[model samples]
Target: MMNKHTQVIRIIMIATLQLFALRNTFSQATAQRPNIIYMMSDDHAYQAISAYGYGLNQTPNIDKLAEQGVLFKRAYVTNSICGPSRAVMLTGKFSHVNGFTDNHSTFDGNQQTVAKLLHNSGYTTAVIGKWHLVSDPQGFDYWNVHPGQGDYYNPDFIENGIRKRVEGYSTNLVTDFAIKWLDQRDKSKPFFLIYQQKAPHRNWMPEPKYYHLFDSVQFPVPANFFDDYSTRTSAAREQEMEIARHMTDTYDLKLAFDLPKESQRGLNSLWTSIYNRLTPEEKQKWEEAYKPSNDAFYKAHLSGKELAIWKYQRYMKDYMRCVQSVDDNVGRLMDYLKANGLDKNTIIIYTSDQGFFLGEHGWFDKRWMYEESFRTPLIVKWPGVTNKKVVTESMVQNVDFAETILEMAGLPIPTDMQGKSFVPLLKGKQKGNVHDALYYHFYENQEHKVAKHIGIRTDRYKLICFYEKNEWELYDLQKDKSEMHNVYNDPAYGKVQAEMKQKLLELKKQYKDPVPEIIP
Candidate 1:
């Protein structure tokens, strides 16, 4: 009954209204979601990264993230070990709460995890690479993790109840798997990806291809490479992980040595067998690296102490060479993200299972609450959300990582989580402090002989009490950054130590830590 032009006008108006409604819905959905990517490295340290002022190594990609976002200077782990730290990061709970107090304690997959929370909130969650926790990983839509520490070459990955041994270096393979998963993920929703790398860890064995890469340079030993462990607590006196004396030759570590004629023949045979397993190119590179060190050892007629120093230098050089490969791979990941246009949207994070001693305090591995072992490297990049080139001196615990991720994702934090959200600190809105003090507990009485110790670290002081020994150690971090002096016995700092001890008590009660002994 109506004219054709009138009917056409009515149809156009209806279409316009529908389009407006659709636009409003889409904007609301997009505003609620933000993509997150968390990348962690094994045994990576703040002191080793060039952005944190390590002169010997260059990590341009890691530094690039720092250039674009916030670099946290005082990031500390709850327990400075592999399994416990990872558990804390995933659950936002302390080791005792999560029941992962040591490497021996198995993680209960039934417990709530960040991945589970994010996935339940409609985010695609994936974890690719080194999962040291004892239980099977839960809450991930797709999971591919290394079996135990994993191998530098030909690592095995457990994928969906199937363990498949894959060839290629662990770092490259992990990255490849992560990228493949990313490509296949549903693009309509936001994602949470954990790309963990097993590199520069203990025994310090690099891929054969990277052996000759740093051969031209001699990496200097740490300034405190020969610490005497004097003027400190008794715990410092018991560690047996020295880089020079403890490294085994069976692990392909570079060592300068001389022995009896018969022993020399045996050594030659061992080296020959190890070399035979390598490709021709690898053999060539190994020979080039060993030749000069061998010549120097024979030419010097070294004895006793001088011989030990030579071995230390060789070990240090090889360790740094392994780290060189890790740095290169970091650059590779950053490059991939930038090339794919995901770098701007993704929140890049870099850290480690725990910090390791690079010849500091004459220690090699980590299990202690010492600064070198407890402090980890933490860098975050969130494009256009935070300012560039800013350093936050606020205290951050590894347990807070889970809550921070949830906060950034706009999800309600679980009530069981003991950590506070650090999202406000990252956004540059929280001015006062993220945490007034951080609590630490390590129950793994491992080879390091480090006793079960619980402590609290404030901005100015550290108070630690060894439970079994019933002893305490205090240090003023503002004055003694290296923790070279223990002031627990000093009468002058009695009041200060008492205050810190009280604070430690308060934290223990708040967190419901089981081993609570009020410091007198």
Candidate 2:
């Protein structure tokens, strides 16, 4: 009935309308996907954060996140060490399953990770800062990571597989690179960015502006600062992490004049290596800040318990100063997000690899399953999803990180992943804890002399097995908050011990850990 030209024109008009509809659908879907920013700091203790209420130091920026989102009170790690905990976070599995059980093992990046899954699902992925798994990052569109436990001043970063030294403090440099990546990324695609920091770790070194930040204020020591390890197993007494005997003057206290002839743990030489990396101008500023304190120490000639207290003061000040810098940089990143109007569509997660000891039980490092070392700080801010200023004691661990992120991105979780997603809990559709019991194991025992141990933590009880030593320790957390008293042999707790032991075995089976059988 119609001419050939008219028929062709009608066909072309219909085709154009269909193509425009398809593009509109794609735009809506992309807008629904939230951009993710995962920020982590090394060895940041929960007690040091003002939001946690210990009041050791003020972290106003980190606390602002808590006030706006959810603050998790009982968040913990799969392992208390650095590399293994990170591996768990990436794969949603324990260290043994991830094949990265210790710091010495290289991560098998070929395996499935959350980053890989997201990248495959059309999201751009990038990781910047400390990647200590001893292997090149995989599943990332861009990566610029630290070589090892990165230096505080003038650090080196391996950018896109080429190593180069960047001038400036490590914390500031990491944040700068993150902002740069966000600015230049593809606007059509949603992104996932890992912004990690190397501050507030061991051998704490603050920036020039923070060197004299806490000079006048004296921090209060923990109630059990002088623990004798009286009732616990031989494992506690044998560890080499005691602050009094193990902490050195030059390396830890930053005293340049009084160098011991024999350095404890060979740390003085390591300190000298780090200090020598500073420029002449930096060195002058450092000396100017520390000289007055060094002179007072020399004049006092203190020793014994008095000297130990002085070391504690010095350690806390330097550690708190480093923490302050991390808080400042967090504020910087937040401002960037707000300025660009990304705050309305971005989800922010702030946490640490593991907790550190600040004179708790006279210890300085993390390894033991004590509360200070085991519990990590977790804060999540989701603009439209989470209830404002929510605080929950729902137990969650590092292993759940991968699965949770995948669910947030509306991607299907891999069947082999072991972690349970906490999206329902976040949405208020689920109540109570996400996990009934959590399992933990530490494989590296050579460094801090903490015996290789496996443990299980429930809501009310904890049971530990020092398998190599054939020892067991149990603690009723409700009664003994400090874990100072071990009740393994107490007759009153006979039923509790038996129940906890059975639960531990069940957890080991559920997680597929091939631990040796314990002789009861």
- Alpha-carbon shift of residue 378 in model 2 (angstroms): 0.3
RMSD of each: 5.1, 2.1
Question: How many clashes does the backbone of model 1 have?
Answer: 0
How much does candidate 2 score in TM-score? 0.96
lDDT of 1 by residue, 87-167 (tens): 999999999899888888889999889999999878888999989996788999899999888776667899976899886
Evaluated against the true structure, the overall lDDT of model 2 is 0.90
lDDT of each prediction vs. the true structure? 0.79, 0.90
| Highest-scoring model, TM-score | 2
What are the per-model numbers of colliding residue pairs?
Answer: 0, 0
lDDT of 2 at 452: 90
lDDT of 2 by residue, 381-431 (tens): 988987488888999999999999999999998888998988888887888
